[model samples]
Target: MRSLEVCKCSKTQAWYLFLVLVVITTLSFTGRVVYLSLGEGYGISLDPSCKPRRHVVFLKTHKTASSTILNILYRYGEARNLTFALPFFDHLGYPQLFKARYVKDFERNPSKEYNIICNHMRFNLPEVRKVMPNQSVYFTILRNPDQVAESSFSYYHDVTPAFREAKSLDRFASRPSTYYSPSAADNHYARNLMWFDLGGDHNAQGDPSYVNSTLQALERAFDLVLLAEYFDESLVLLREALCWPIEDMAYFRLNARLRLSVAPLAPAASSKLRQWNSLDWSLYSRFNRSFWERVARYGAVRMERDVSQLREIRRRLGATCLRGDAPAGAAETVPAEIRPPSFGTAKILGYVLRQDLTGPTRELCTRMVLPESRYLSLLQRKQALIKLPHNMENRL
Candidate 1:
């Protein structure tokens, strides 16, 4: 009977130990989930990495906060050390038709694989397809035509011959045809730039058939179309579409022209601007609704939660990556690395990185503020070094 009691006691102790182990394991798992929630996205799908989508084709449209999105892509791809279908020029033949020939070091039956293709290219889907993988996710951003035109007019005043003598957006909006000419050089900037950039006829006049066909084509070809106005919500949906982690989506505003230099678009001016850029207006109006519907599919309530979390993360990152006590509106306030090149007569905003950081933290902070031009240059240099003979790398 003593032996029987001793054996029963041993069994009871073993059961208690197993129960304790189960409790500890459960707590540890719950703790990890909690920790991730605090730093990453709230209300995001539990398993972001279950099946991550890496290959992407982001059409970088101009004056639509596309630069900021590019920065996000650049950081994510760079972090993973993923290969890029880098263009021979600054971009993959931007403002010109994208071709496989535009991709640097690309040849017939090239063996190297690319994971990301985010650059300014006058998108030609077939030509673009030859560069990236078959499974690459396609996406782009669009902005309100009035706002985009206002920005483009301000930035491209000199480059766009149409805006040269117009002097101001209001003046151009007052009598647009007086200044705008189809025959003018860089006339695309003065017209339906987004449509032109997407390989559509920017000059198409009141053809709903053409517009509908183009929209359908875009719908079929691209996985997502982000709106610059609803940028945060778009980003949340993008996170869902790409199955990207919250950290990969964080970004700082890039290429902001100082507000002091820009005037508010009057209601009438806005209307006139939209009327003048009818094709872009139509595209924006159609897609804005569709984009919202896409957000709803992703769950607007959850999207709101994620957006709030994303903002919080951006705020925290801003504090970490940028120097404080700098004037918000001054051109000289931030360093060149963060600042985009000034356009025409606009005072474009930039940022200064934190001075006290070093090592990986330092690199992260610096890159957060790096300009698109410098980032491209840096990326290209890295790529060049990568292609060099291992024995000859020291000479580089």
Candidate 2:
């Protein structure tokens, strides 16, 4: 009788412990679900006091070290717990889509305004006002047209299949007019120089109408303009204008790779490049003069001096460390071993879903999803996953 009683007590204790474990597991899952549903959107503070109250828009151009600046802004946003009107797609091309009321609708519940909005958006004044109604600051960088053309040509030639068949740079440089004449899908000059920065179509010839439009926009919308050639100086002015932290002004090196070199261009080839880019040179010179005039009128010198003082402060704070051999605005390279794989359909879908979701639910869903093959393929190719078509999905 005593033996039987002891066995019964042991069985009851085991059942109680099992019940407790099951309850704990269920509670853990429920807590996660609740956090996902309510917590993520409120996690970041987009209040005006965190940085400055005004809207800041950066016109990101190719090969102008714009990416480096964007990275800094992104970091600043993160530190301040602010949110960017990050594009649904990989790049921001259409300004018409981001109107003031549209942005308000996009940011429906937050009740707060955006501190900064920067992306690869086309230059549109009325559209910009729709999003940033008050005293918003607008800025962009300009590079020497000749250098811009050369860099753009080389970049496309190395990366795109259309340029791969060209025998030499001379062949590519021979036809400067065709480089940006709508036929070239990789029309960097047309896109970066004409539409986005200058607010005009490249097909039109020598109309200062675009220039006038840009100037008017500056008068009405922008407080500052930056030159890519003088990037350090540009950042200094930016720092002073925004009264940003000194560390924020420091340049970051990002997105660069060492390449094997071909022989130096012959004198004939060099001259060809110059001859081909005559239109670019002319436009650059014309715009540059106007840009300087605007700067003078705005008392940019005083801004520069203020920036210099801020740099000194940053130097004292030990945040002024310079990168070795890295070009301005390049990102640090990840080691091959730890780097994520390429993008594929599933990855693209996952990215889109994450962007679509709001609050804690989005965060939870993002964490729960498995690493899809599409993502791995995209990482390997270094291209936007969504750009690939459904027909080619299997190729990834």
Clashes of each: 0, 24
Residue-level lDDT of model 1, residues 1-396, one tens digit each, is 755543555454545546655644432212122224335544355463457688999999999999989988887777666788887768877677878788887883366688898888898999888788899999999998888888898889999987897888888988888988888878889999998889898888958798899988988888889999988888888887888877667777888887787778988888888888998888788788889888778776777788988878777667766777332543564555555688887787777777786655666767766788888887786666445342222322
lDDT, candidate 1, equals 0.77
In model 2, how large is the Cα lDDT of residue 315? 38
Model 2 alpha-carbon drift over 4 Å, by segment = 1-53, 94-112, 158-167, 177-184, 188-197, 208-220, 256-283, 290-396
TM-score: model 1 vs. ground truth: 0.85
lDDT of 2 by residue, 1-396 (tens): 755543554445545446545544432222134332333332222234555534677767665666557755654553344445555455545533334433323444334455666766666667665555366667776676545544444555544333444535556556544433445554544233433344545444435665456445544555665677776667765765676644455433332222322224556766775554444455456557766775575477665664565445333322212222222211122222212232111011111121344554432333222132222222223212112233222232
Residue 26 local lDDT, model 2: 33
Residue ranges of candidate 1 with Cα displaced over 4 Å = 1-45, 108-111, 325-330, 333-336, 388-396
The residue-level lDDT of candidate 2 at 312 comes to: 55
